[model samples]
Target: MAKIPKVPKTVLPKPPRQAVPPPPPYVPLRARPVRPQRTNLPNQQSPPHPSAQETPIAPPGTTRSDRLKQVWDERPRVSDIKRLTPEQLSAPTHQNRMNKWRQWTLFICGMSAFGMGLYGMQIYVSLTTAPDENAVPDDLSDRFDKEADGYDEKVSMAETMLFLNSRRKALMQKVRGHVLEVAVGTGRNTPYYPTKQCATVTLLDSSAPMLEVAKRKWKETHMEYFSRVFFKHQSAVDPITPPYGAQDGYDTVVQTMGLCSTNEPVKLLHSLEAATKEEDGQILLLEHGKSHYEWLNSFLDRTAPNHALTHGCWWNKDIGKIVEESGLEVVDMKRYNFGTTWWVELKPRKGMRKQLEDAAKEEVEVAVQKSWSWWSFWR
Candidate 1:
């Protein structure tokens, strides 16, 4: 083991050096020939092919004519562009624009109509349920006064003013001696009264609050005529008997937008006739009546029960017949707004001054006639 370890101390052979290849030599580029300068002319242009000097020469045995022929066959030729007809050019744009405008207009009109219909429906619902004496308690008078004071703010006062103004002059001229204004709400028409021509006006209303408001307004505005104006808180049916007294009967009784809500229009008319001096007194009425148009009448008839329930007013009362049956003569009846309303002037017939007394006496006769008719029917 000792002799083998001593023999291993030998030197290794040295490694050989590797050779690296040298980089290729750089050559200087030859200068190219300069092309002739071009003139700044609009019609002048260079050919699309390369110059002869810049092109490579073909090797021996190559055909140059075949390449030139192939290039010529591949070129595009110039041709005229076709034009559109005059009608075709103009029609499409104009028609498309018009159609778009028409569609927009129709859409806007339909929206407007729908909005108007909704507004009308709301108004119908509101007016049909408007409070009146027959339906509401006595406390409603205060509510009505509060409501009416704010009517302009709640509703369109401009339209209401215009409608009231239209009737002002007419009503003022028609008033005469012992004039009574029935259901004079807030007295919008009070300013229009002819104080000088009319001897006295008894403003009658069932609503004490409304009467109070009317009196206050009258005193505030026409304090001078306060003595001539009398405000009575009473129902329309409270019999024109003593204490109230019918000694000096009314000469002209006027009602505007009042009769429609009267609980018993016929009875009221008869009572009015009883309260008036024969032939001298008159009843002037301006009322919106049942429409004469078939469709409108049908609609009104259908809705009348609901209207009456809400408004405390009847829409289909035969007012003309009521006046006639009350022994009053219709002096004039004029239809307005396509027979949707009437301006009626009536008076007690001559010799019918004692109509109430006569009616009282004839009660037995009417009863006897009814009894006879019933007996005859059975026979």
Candidate 2:
């Protein structure tokens, strides 16, 4: 038994010693987690973590300024800049971002207030002193009389804007033969009439005082070329069929920036057609209408009330559509000033009379269904 035990002991080598894992990673006691700094605005972001290389541990700095200088110096050099991502390039720094947010918030609040004010004003105008059945309101006659004396001078202030020199020269030179000018304010079109070819002239306006100013303008110009010059104080909105119409009607109907403020622009167009002779008669217009540009149109809309009060002009009228609706054939039309200014040449179509009559009847029926008490638009 002793021999067997010795043999086993001699054969077996010591079992390989086991290797122990390195002691668990040394972890120092963690300080209380720093609560993030609160910001007044929403979406505030956390500060970026600086890499160990970027973070300069000031060696017992002598002063706070010196410590800050050392920290800034640790910032990445220019050679390392190419490693930056697009987010870093596109994003504003925290302070700049906060400032931009504040400015946008203020701007949005201001625009909201302005929009609300415009809505309130539109509602107020709709409720008070709506227009009547008569296309030309009675008060408008009195208002024109008041504006008559200084009308030319006041309108002249816009000369540079209107290109009055070139437009008037082009528009007025077209009128020839017995001419009828409807709603011819202050005879602005008189000087443009063909000096040699105009046989007779008839000036019509709703305001007697305005007619007087036109008469004065004609006299001042000394237009001896005309066989006769007649001044009529009549609303062009009325039917131009009989005694009220020009004695011999007209060979040309001239409208210069007239129908923008008219109570019934379509009606006035019908009357102009009625007053024009069936043969060789046409309408020439130099007018301002809605601008094609949205920005300019929005500006005009915002200042609608001021323009309505100052000049009897509608800044956003659709003159082109009105001409089409009137059933007049447009021989030629030129748009200038971003389509805000219209130079139109019109002639009577064969079936215009029936179209206008039907339109009048439909207008009556429309009024019966839903009343229209003021000018066409909000202004």
Which candidate leads the pack in TM-score? 2
What does candidate 2's lDDT look like per residue over 1-379, in tens digits?
A: 3554444355678899999888976643342233455566788765532211132234663698887676567454555547767676554453354455568779988876776686567645643533432333324456577899998776663564457657988888788887888878788777666767777777888888888888888887855743378777788876554233445457788888887767678878887886776667888888887888998787566555445554655667888889988888899999898888888999886666556656667776887768655564765
Candidate 1: tens digits of C-alpha lDDT, residues 137-212: 3232343445556533433443343354566558668887777877776676777887888777788877776677
Best by lDDT: 2
Off by over 4 Å in 2: 1-139, 223-227, 241-248, 351-379
Q: lDDT score of model 1? A: 0.64
Task: Note the residue pairs that clash in candidate 1.
Answer: none
Superposed Cα deviation of residue 189, candidate 2 (Å): 1.8
Candidate lDDT scores, in order, read 0.64, 0.71
lDDT of 1 at 266: 74
